[model samples]
Target: MGADDKTQNNAEKLGGKVQEGLGKATGNKDMEAEGQKDQSKADLKNAGENIKDAFKGK
Candidate 1:
């Protein structure tokens, strides 16, 4: 993936982590679930980028 996309995905993952921490601290199930979802989505995107990079021999 391009640098910008990678950066954005990383940022998203970090944000998700922070959100998850906050949710846990606040005892919010819904927020925790949402944060987990966000993290999963970012991970999926990063995996896709890794596959693309592998194909390109980067």
Candidate 2:
């Protein structure tokens, strides 16, 4: 993956983690679910980037 893409994905994952933690602490199920969804999306994007890089032999 490109450096920018990696950084963005990491940031997204971190944000999601923070959101999830806050939701759990405050007993907000919706926030927790949203956080989980965000994390999942970031993960999927990361995976796609990895696959692309592998195919390109980078």
Candidate 3:
């Protein structure tokens, strides 16, 4: 994957983690769920990127 894509994915993951932490601390179920969703999306994106890279023989 490209460096920019990787960096953005990592940043998203980190932001999700922070959101999850804050949500838990504040007892907000919706925010926590949103954070979980965000993390899942980032994971999916990274997986897609990896598959693309593999197909490209990288």
Highest TM-score: which candidate? 2
> For residues 1-58, could you state the per-residue lDDT of candidate 2 as single tens digits?
3879988998999999999999999999999999998899999989988998899899
- lDDT of each candidate versus the true structure: 0.89, 0.91, 0.87
User: Tens-digit lDDT track for model 1 on 1-58?
Assistant: 3677888999999999989988999999888888899999999999988888889889
Better of 1 and 2 by TM-score: 2
| Candidate 2 segments exceeding 4 Å error | none
Report backbone clashes per prediction.
0, 0, 0
**Cα deviation in Å at residue 19, candidate 2?**
0.2
TM-score comparison, 2 vs 3, better candidate: 2
Q: Give the Cα-based TM-score of candidate 2 against the true structure.
A: 0.93
Best by lDDT: 2
1-58 per-residue lDDT for model 3 (tens digits): 3667877998998899899989999999898888888888988888988888889889
TM-score for model 1? 0.92
